[model samples]
Target: MASEGLHAPRERLTEKTLNLHHAIVSLTEELDAVDWYRQRADDCDDAQLKAILLHNMREEMEHAVMVLEWLRRNDTDFAGMLKEYLYTEGDIAHHED
Candidate 1:
């Protein structure tokens, strides 16, 4: 059987591909956690609990960014795209022009 999320046989994949898959999965989970935490915090009535949930959400965001940075460092495409799109002024959709 293949590893949990693999679309192809694990034996057919390269070591680098497996590592990238791991990073991608971790990043997805982290972002999902952030969204879930934010939703729960929004519905929470207790101030202290809400604060704690929001704090946890931010931590998840940090984890996601760390994973993204790993991808950026390891993949030239990610590095190029991030450089082109991130932290720029004006209309984002027009950046390609």
Candidate 2:
């Protein structure tokens, strides 16, 4: 079956590209879920439900991070960028220039 949000014909894509597509799509969905849960938590009046929503949002963030790690592992460019940009104390934008 064809994957969602594919910009080109599936037949034209290699297996590696397809797998990356899947990971990117999954990352997008997880990030979106995190946003949604955050909004819901903010709007919630019930403390317990708000806590649940916030907890779910954190889980979604974890999922997004895992997908990012997968991308870093599978793609050299991503690995390089992550190494350059992640966990550094100095100005981040300076690295881009």
Candidate 3:
């Protein structure tokens, strides 16, 4: 598939950068899918179809989280930020300070 959202020329990007781009794009798509599936589930009148849509939404959420973890593993800044903010119980915005 053609690179739809690239800001720079394809040939200019390094392999690592390209891979990061792919992950970022995939994450975006996964999040979009999650939103779409949840909305469909919310709107559906049929019980079985709603269940299926909710299940698909959860799957999409899983995909999004996997991609996010990949980003944290690959990018030091992401790793640092995630460490600072994730899984903590406090005033989140104030926790940064």
Which lDDT values do the candidates have, in the order given?
A: 0.94, 0.94, 0.93
lDDT of 1 at 44: 100
Using TM-score as the measure, the top candidate is 1
- Candidate 1 C-alpha RMSD relative to the actual structure: 1.5
Native-referenced Cα lDDT, model 2: 0.94
Q: For residues 1-97, could you state the per-residue lDDT of candidate 1 as single tens digits?
A: 3346988888899998998899999999999999999999999999999999999999999999999999999989889999999999999998788
The candidate with the higher lDDT, 1 or 3, is 1
lDDT of 3 by residue, 1-97 (tens): 7668888998998988898999999999999999999999999999999999999999999999999999999989889999988899989878957
Against the hidden true structure, what lDDT does model 3 obtain?
Answer: 0.93
RMSD of each: 1.5, 1.3, 1.2
lDDT of 1 at 67: 100
* Model 2 misplaced stretches (Cα beyond 4 Å): none
CA lDDT of 7 in candidate 1? 85
Per-residue alpha-carbon lDDT of model 2 for 1-97, expressed as tens digits?
Answer: 6677888988999998999999999999999999999999999999999999999999999999999999999999899989988998878878677
